[model samples]
Target: MKTEKRKLAIWMTMEAIEVIGLKRIVLDRDVAEAVGFFHAVIAPQVFATAERFGIHRVDVEETEDGRLPG
Candidate 1:
């Protein structure tokens, strides 16, 4: 028997206060790496907004293709 490898991608959406509004980001990485990237790169800024402009929501989706349907 043979197996095939598949590519994975991560889609993230964040809603912040009035200033930031809504932001969407995409990463071509596996779930673990994508989460790590978010913690390392995006989380700090998001946490900073927690005082006044808190984050409304954060969504993470995994897809074979790094894109949403048109």
Candidate 2:
């Protein structure tokens, strides 16, 4: 279950990156959560990819559901 969730989260994050482009835009965890996976489990992977794309300075804001702010 955890692995599936992680994979789903990674896919979701990648999709978001593809759609939004790896710019200075904030990543709302709510948008990710709506995909139905836990952010904490997938954040490291997402951030890793962002880093690979040279997105070092990320702004992880908190929403009502404690999601990463966009």
lDDT (CA) per prediction: 0.45, 0.51
Q: Where does candidate 1 stray beyond 4 Å?
A: 1-28, 52-70
**Worst ten in a row by lDDT for model 2:** 4-13
- What's model 1's lDDT at 65? 61
lDDT of 2 by residue, 1-70 (tens): 4555323233544566544533322355355454444344357677877777676635455346645654
**Candidate 2: global Cα-lDDT?**
0.51
- TM-score for every candidate vs. truth? 0.33, 0.32
Q: How many clashes would you count in candidate 2?
A: 2
lDDT for predicted candidate 1 compared with the true structure:
0.45
Residue pairs with backbone atoms closer than 3 Å in model 2 (clashes) = 26-70, 61-69
